[model samples]
Target: MGIRDFADYLGISDRAISNWEAGGESYRPRAASQSVLDTGLARAPDEARARFADALGVSGPGPSAAAEMSVDSHKFLPVFIGSDRAHRLRTQMTGETPPDWLESCSAIVAHPHAPTCTLHVFACGVVVFHILQPRKPASLTELAVWRYRSYASDLPWARAKIHDLLGEHHPHGPNPEYVLSLYWLTAGPWIGSQYDTAMRLLSTPSVLVDRSAPGGPVPLDGAVEESLLATGFDHPDIVSFGVRGVSTGYAGWSGVSYAALSQERSLTVEELVSCELIVQALWCYTHHIQQRIEEGSDPSTPDRYGWRFLRAANSRLTTARAQETAQHCLMREAIMRTSGLAERLRAAQEALRESMG
Candidate 1:
């Protein structure tokens, strides 16, 4: 049985089980040898032995208490703060409880199964404990535990990013939006590659925004949209990976742009649209050439088909001399066909002029 079940059977706390598993004491299935039972088994020995055997689901007698028990410290670490927090909080809970590592920060945020304390580590590897206050609901620890599992299984670089992110600062307050964004920037590839994991992260507390707050920044709707779009563009194989879902990585990016756009000198939609068109044209032309190069032939190699297609596409686009002529022609024709659009444009111009006055 696991240490948790054993702890329940012995009527001891899980921490105590951790401590026992660490060293100072030893425990065994009571139904060992008849001689050792008389020596080591504590209190109402026969009854305790039967209870222990029943609790462990073992029918027959096991080894004596005198038999060497392998109490692994490494194994106990994961059970305590979990694999993610183990390396971070090890000294505070188990190893040499360093004086420098102790810092009075917060209260114990206990999981039903295992209590946890958050700590910061200094450059010298000294840990400073800042226990988190318990949440009213039990899901807080469950969330942490789930993240612990997910984050632990990440690539080494991704794990480092998660550690750096969580360890950096919490005093800035409940900025889950920011945290989620950082994860995207640093560990997005891993999260995006898996649909379920990416969706789970999105549903977490950090990504969700409070809409009712007055004077808050523009909602993260755009960033969320963009993120999901990026994921779809990059990882269409999420379904083949046994996860079926679509997600956006755009929300996080749009969230970041909130502060900038809210400030003075933001670009108008027309300007933005123009910029997007240019970028799109560039991307199409670049990708066409890149795909040809990536497929087989080198750029240095003369490709009759590629060069011919490229020249034709380039010829259709305007030269510097034709730019004004082309614009004049299009505007004259558009004015003749779309008088309503011209009226709306005039109204928008008048509104802007009136607002400035």
Candidate 2:
């Protein structure tokens, strides 16, 4: 029935029915009036019933409607870390225990059924700990255990690689390149892509040198120049190695330089372990930033600990663009799911009306 007909049938004014149909906050029907309309709709003609259902935003049968709902209707998982580990690390670093809240962050990583994305966020927390308190690098080991315990079945190879790396001893020190390769293997495809892209951006010649001087080459700091050289790009022509210019030879050179020169490999085995930990931590940091962006949180917002580790890593790799890309990807998935759900609902409602008729 039309709104006017329904209003007359329910003993209400047409304007009141119009207000209910419009769904304006100021004109919400009382429970009795709403129940009266529901009863009328329940007994109405098929076409009129469908029309009223549409006006009321009732898409289809409740069960079917719920089944077709999108990810937008579900809450995203929160980023979590091990509170006990975080507190222990904090205590080790500061010679005092952390606050209660800081010590009470959920131990999401240890939970066997935690989502993979949540585990990634926990990995980032481990990285943050490594950066903020290098003296307490045990978090990385804990992260490895968490990852293995939580995802061993799905990511068996990654867990195996972690075991091999941690269990085996390297006399010459674990090659930074080798450690990084393992990280890429375990980090999943998207994170590996982000790391490669970030590395390429850092290695760009224009980024390394002064832009204004076409003739005169800018002198880079010794370490910066060394790192660039290690990437196999000649000083002035480094721009030739664009975003997709990653190479194994360059990786080896860079890895060795990072391990030997940057980290100073004295105890070879420990140095290798340290190299793996550092690379994994950096990747985790990148993932953390991406997770924050997807959660609709401000990526740059200051936190309790001021995100010292994230800031330090970003200073070197500049994860802003990569994080933006991740955010866009998440939004696209949500939009696609929403669109799909709407289409499915429309189809289901049409089918329902056809069956009713």
Candidate 3:
């Protein structure tokens, strides 16, 4: 349920409930509020408080608050082997143990308002939360509109400070989760490559999401990309710019494959750490792509069998110095935009203050 529904049940304003969900404010529910949720849900007090805090984005009132908030629920999902649920779910779902740091994982905090539900795990003193959001197809018109708006919003600020400082904007897909789900798939080289390639693909506003039909592996030159590009999607290969790019495609597949993977395992500490690097790589690739696209060049290979060309293109984009330069440019542009807007806004505020005086 959304925050408003919970607030109404508790005789509080929606904002109050929102604050509790977001936490860290003076209004963050303390012991008393924890009691209300516990008694209302008839669940374990700790689980309830943790859920409350999680739904609100707060760390509940520590262990004591959890002690008071316990209750029980009858629903049960089969405990599978090699899964975190086989261990923690019974305790959490039954309100037996104090909730682990899963409720407070960084994935949840970073993507607090994501539409899809998430699963979090705590191992070795680190929290790794997996985010799962459904992916949808985009029409070419949708792509154009998305590209226009994304470029408009991101480029204005980018232009105010540094050149080539474009932001990644998805006009036609699901909402941009604050922390994109790059950690959900296989970790290591696959993750790294996908991270790097997604950045490169984003540079040209290409449709990076794969939507082949449900039959045998869908054709790469299918309707989805054509629909997104309005023209035949010019590329070296249908899958991974051709077979060589499959490693790159593997990364994209992993980034968007949280659902299939979620059923198999919980997010690990190493995965989260790797995801940060992957995302940074993505940001750098996107910036580089944006710069080239703005100048009317395709960042991916021109021919379908152009792995060598794509590889060289990929190499130029992944060098540490290149990535760092792109980051500096984006940050510099953001600062300049902030400063300019602050100046104008301050002037307007001063004029009002003087008029009132």
Candidate 4:
């Protein structure tokens, strides 16, 4: 921040700031001013804190080491394309070789909304669209405001892309329940353990920031960050999928994942996205049946997605496979419990049984 901006932020004079700068270690502000400075440090965006730490010769995870050297936003929209469509697209689109452990491959696709978007096709019936938007946020607060404002329109844009992709490629495939979102944060100004607070707020944006303000939501500045720091933040629906320090994130019913560092992330992005795809597709499928029960009609789907299909999905999702990590298992279970996927599946199963009887 510039000198004047810093002064205005602290509710003080620019000249006083100049004197403090000139005085260096010799001049210390009075008690009230010291309190204000402390709040400024606490409430300032992750970037400002990073620079402050850098100036003080304290080193940590600053965004300077990143390839971009600036903050960027990653948005993912995943849908189910099933095995057959995934195969067809694999042949149609030229893609880089997949990692031996991964059954997924991605390719750049023409998108009307975002030029830098790519389509990731997973062997297990899921496809995700990844969009990258470059931005220079002055503070985490500024970024928070932008996220709340832009998300209103982003869902529709993704839905349009999915509609087009399916219309042209997989007409008979099951429709996506919703264009659910998952966010990844890369190269932010936040340093040290501050990334923890940043990730919590990012994962559940509505907790600290009031997004319901009349003239659109505005950041409460230090009040926002300070409150979270003091009381902590948690929501039953939001699941923390990654570890705390090396890399961090949470996946929730509201959104899939929000993380600070892209490197050595605790949970693979593929697992989180695939988990969401299965959960939401099942959620949508069961909802269709539940609605039919509500309307006094017997519900039915193509034999492929019938009761047996749900039974296999339940076992596949609930059972532990040979090589699954505990973290991956925990994340999948948390998503199922929080989203009520298991409950929905049982309810749908019962309804189907009664109709068949």
Candidate 4 overall Cα lDDT vs. reference? 0.63
Give the alpha carbon lDDT tens digit for every residue of 1-357 in model 1.
687885565555678657545664454422322222222222334566457546544422111111221110000010111223434544344333235211211123222232443333322222223222222222222333333332223223222333453474333321111111111111122222343333333333233333344643223444553474345332221111000111122122111110011111222223322222222222223333344445664332123223343333233322222323222222222222222223333333333334334
Per-residue lDDT for 316 in model 2?
32
lDDT tens string, model 3, 1-357? 678786777666788676775765554455556445433443234465446446643332211221121111010001011123223332343323245312222222223323533233222111223333322223222322333333333323322211111122434211211232231223212132333342223323335332333431222344554353333332332122111111122123112211111211122334333333323322322333344446775544223212332243333333333223222222222322322322333333333234334
Candidate 2: misplaced stretches above 4 Å?
A: 1-85, 88-124, 127-269, 299-308, 314-357
Model 3 global lDDT (CA atoms, 0 to 1) = 0.30
Ranking by lDDT: 4, 2, 3, 1
lDDT of 4 at 121: 69
The weakest ten consecutive residues by lDDT in model 2 span 241-250
Give the clash count for model 1. Answer: 14
When sorted by TM-score, best at the front, the candidate numbers are: 4, 2, 3, 1
Query: How close to the true structure is residue 254 of candidate 1, measured as C-alpha lDDT?
Result: 13
Residue 83, model 3: lDDT of 23
Give Cα-based local distance difference scores for all models.
0.29, 0.31, 0.30, 0.63
Best by TM-score: 4
Off by over 4 Å in 4: 1-109, 112-115, 118-136, 162-179, 191-193, 208-210, 213-222, 244-246, 256-265
Task: Point out the higher-scoring one by TM-score: 1 or 2.
Answer: 2
